[model samples]
Target: MWQIILKRENEISLSRQLFYAMKDMILEGQIRSGEALPSSRGLAKDMSISRSTVNEAYDMLETEGYIVTHQGAPTRVKEGLYLEKHQKHHEEALFPVITLADKPYKVDFKTGQPDVSLFPRYVWNQMMYKSFEQLSDKDLGYFGTAGYESLRVEISHWLFRKRGLSAKPQDIFITSGTTQALSILVTMLSKAGLPFAVEDPCHRGLLEVIENSGNSILGISVDQEGMKTALLEAHDFSAVYVTPSHQFPLGSILTAERRIELIRLARQKKFYIIEDDYDSEFRYVGASVTPLYSMDKEQVLYTGSFSKTLYPALRIGFVILPPKLHSEWMYLRKHLDVQNPIVEQAALAEFLNQRKLDKYIQQISRMYEKKRKALTTSIYECFGEQCSILGDETGLHLVLKIPGAHFDEFFIEKCQNAGIRVFPIEHYCISKGNHMDQLMLGYGHLKVEEIQKSVSRLYNLIMDTE
Candidate 1:
């Protein structure tokens, strides 16, 4: 009898273990093709298992075409079933997974980080409880891929009041976050196979989504007013992605003239504009910058996220899609995770209805403004006239530009080695060498004292490097 071991105490059934053992032996050529397997009754007697268990395992092997059974003869291994055994490495993992705790930086200026401590968790919990209590049987099942109607309506209202953008509840499709929205949009729009256009120095993670789809990317450089729209006239694109509200890394608002120009070109050239309204709400300056979506709702796909406003784990965002594109968007979204969870959507709806989010934004904006001021002040104190801050008027982060200073990979590594985590603007650039003298500093999650101390440490590191 072939050597067969069974562990009755194991959670796996005896039959499964036997099947796996036999299959391995067959593949490893220990049991050659056309070789006869022992009869079920005899194998069961040898292994001390029930006759039925052996039959079940044999049945599986037969059904899978790994073995063939004839009514009057023994089960025989199928032809071409044998596979050479490959050597297994027993070495320990060379690269251990690094987590947030691994690289303990004295100060980290990671961008797009929000001060989660300022979020009203108790209020949100109460809302969540209410949403759960009110859930109907229908709510637990697949709600529409478009998302909860109540949440959409509330979002519509919030958009109108805050951004002055009038969007119908039907047009607003709820997503897990802006990242999901971008991924789906990239797929939907890139069907034409035309190159996708994005800011040269754009959000790296979002850029990867488009790049991963195997679509050609056109990197349009950005100036103080935003994307260099003049360069766009030369090429045909499937879509153009821009952060008009608050340009990432550089922190420049796309001027009204450029916004109009983009809309015009999108209309003439027949390309969709992706407006990522990142960090648009917490403007420290005069007023929150109007979204490019407001200018041309039909031409622009507007995306917004509550991840920075609330907590990262909350994972709620939305896109205001045009009506003509809705059916296709829904089809793509249905195949990609169907829809978001109902409880969070319902809870967020209630939160919006009660004006809690509006109040929270107002409260948090004040605190963020203070942190921004402190960060700028500290930078001035440390680097003096050599360094100038950009994009402090809006967003949780700003760019620090030092003329004649190259914040390349070596500098970034050196800073990290010195217990500081600061990101250079060039890190996010699609086409490098354009922005080599700047660094992005996120102060939203840091306390005033932490900001000051981090700036001092950053200055010391820079001075040492110089």
Candidate 2:
């Protein structure tokens, strides 16, 4: 009789439970190495289950090298199958429960995240449901390495209409998100043998991504106009990253003259520009500012994402590669993720085709614009002449500069105690000792009332620090 008992009502699948039970026995040496396992037919009869179910359990063990079998012979536990048991460390649990937000902050001005509650989930669900209703054999199989071609075409048109950038569908490739696209590009662009020139006080998460790839990052100073291209004429670099549409932390648009200057520098120095046009859709001002990719397609690798606009979990973004790099990008992407899931791509394509995305962006822009006003007005009321706001022209966040105030970790700790969580601009600086007096406040996800309350709390924190 089989030693293991099956649970029919458990949430875990039967085959997986069976496999785990056998694996535990093997590792504990209760099932001795070289001992033959009961035949599938015998075990199935003992357990009152189908032979196929028993065979599946054996197949998993065999595939994992836990057991061995020869032609026309019974399966036996592999030698050295026993593993020494170690006491479980609570922190080392396979799925340890980590607290994402332990502190009950009254308001968190976290940047680069949108209020997704307003997204039209009903419409999106309908589109996704339709994709499954008409699912095809090819769609469920290896559709292609590049991406869903129709989605690519739709993205190409969307970019053209939204940002005035014309790109062929063949050159567009889908990725998991903006980070993946930039990560892949890091590998491809590293061959040029020069450090990546990035903005000095740029996105810290992005800097971590570049550092993880073992690439050197050279800091380019950013002014009110954005990535100071004039700083690049002296030093050589393989590539430069800019948040041109609305700069990252600083939230300044790259000026037209500087945009042209960047293109000229890249051409003259033989470098590439990595434009992260993230959150451009929510610009509170004029139509989304034109991207650098529009100035020169061949030199710029453009990245855009649907995470902020639709929802962060969508994990869908695209990159427009030049014709020359298409082959390498395709090979690398195929090996990395294969391709993005088709169901969402199809759903997003339908989302774009029906002009729902355009309407969604329009509505959210107005909502965020009002939140931005509330935030600035609150800052003025609280600190009056003590504080100044920058980069309010666009983006979900703005820079609040408090002159003569050096905000540091101590200041942040005080804010935490007061039930406020806001980030100082110095945290994002690659070169420190600068921007210690400034803080970045994101208002897009905060309600009008929350913004008003958070700013007042922030003012008190600043006052206490001084």
Candidate 3:
């Protein structure tokens, strides 16, 4: 007699369950090779199930090579189906739990993160709903890699109005984010084994993108005036990447003179300049700085992302390419994930067309500016004049420099143990030993009270270490 148990109460189809049970028995050697299985009619009668259900299970077993069946012939177990049971490995259970603290960190100064809670959910939901309703059948299909045409057009218009830059819709290519845009640009522009020049204390993630492409990177140091353009002439470069509007960690605007000098060098050396205009939308100071792409469109690959402006989950960003590079860009983009999803793109296009994004940016900028002030005020109050703040004029984070204080891994780890999280400027440096006295603190996502308390905690931690 067969020992097959059926679970009629289970939600799974009877055929599937029977199939799994039979397959397991075959693998476990309970059902020997070449052994004939029970007839479909007899098994159905014995189990009180339909003959078709038993037939379906047998069909699946035969299809998977667990059993073999032929016209008017017995269904026999396939040969060599047995497999040894794997022993359970519980090695991970032997490890001790190392607790930093009982509770979560008092503060986390994570950079490049915006306050997503303040986003207009209702309005955005409305845009998404409308987009879903209005999208033609063709829109839901594989749209072009160049991106939603209407969204591109709206982005072009918004750029002119917001940043005073002129970009054509045809030349704009949508990407998942600035990260993806940078990765593709690095791969495309890397030439003949020539290195890509980048700011020394650059965004580590962006640096990795260039490094992963198998191209050498030339780390040009940055200062209070941004990347040292004078050092760029020492070697031949395929392309140069710079954050011109507001530098990443140090937060310095690329002065007009330095911008011109960099462009001149690129022209003379026949290299392209990748201008990453990330997080310039929330500038709390004077009018936003002019992008380098506006200066020389032919040689500058301008990239921007809405992750900081809107929400990080939006995953919508763009790069402005010259006519010569458009074909290659499409070819590369096609190979990399084919294209981003269509619903989000359509919703974003509608959102841009209605100027909802402009309104949201205006609303959030005021709040972020206030948060920035709270952070600066707290830093000044905590360490007084001993700690000076840098790059507070714009962006969600600022550099806090303590003249004699060295912020390293040990200091950061100690702070983390005390339930506080802060990053060192040196963490982002390509060449170590520089920016040892500076710590990077992001405040755009923190409340005023949290900023004050976190700064106080940070102050105590620093004093205790000293």
Q: After superposition, how far is residue 299 of candidate 2 from its true place, in Å?
A: 0.6
- Poorest 10 consecutive residues of model 2 by lDDT? 86-95
Candidate 1 per-residue C-alpha lDDT over 1-466 given as tens digits, one digit per residue, 9 for 90 to 100: 5777889899999898888998888898899999998889998888888999999999878888899988898889999988865444422254455676647778988877899887888998999999999999999999799999999999999999999999999999999999999999999998566888899898899778987989878889998999999899999988999999889879898998898999999999888999998788898789778888888989999999899888789899999999999999999999999999999999999999999999999999999989988999999999999889998899889999999888998998898788888899899988889888899998888988778888998998888888
lDDT of each: 0.90, 0.87, 0.90
- Deviation from native of the Cα of residue 28 in model 2, angstroms: 2.6
Q: Give the C-alpha lDDT of model 3.
A: 0.90
Q: Write the per-residue lDDT of candidate 3 for residues 24-136, one digit (tens) a residue.
A: 98899998999999999998898899999999999899888899887898989989989987644544466656887635667888788899887988988888888888889
Which ranking of candidates, highest TM-score first? Answer: 3, 2, 1
Backbone clash pairs in model 2 (N, Cα, C under 3 Å; residues 3+ apart or in different chains), count:
0
List candidate 3 stretches off by more than 4 Å. Answer: 1-7, 27-30, 41-51, 80-103
List of clashing residue pairs for candidate 1: none
Q: Over 4 Å off in model 2, which ranges?
A: 1-26, 30-80, 86-97, 100-103
TM-score, model 3 to reference = 0.93
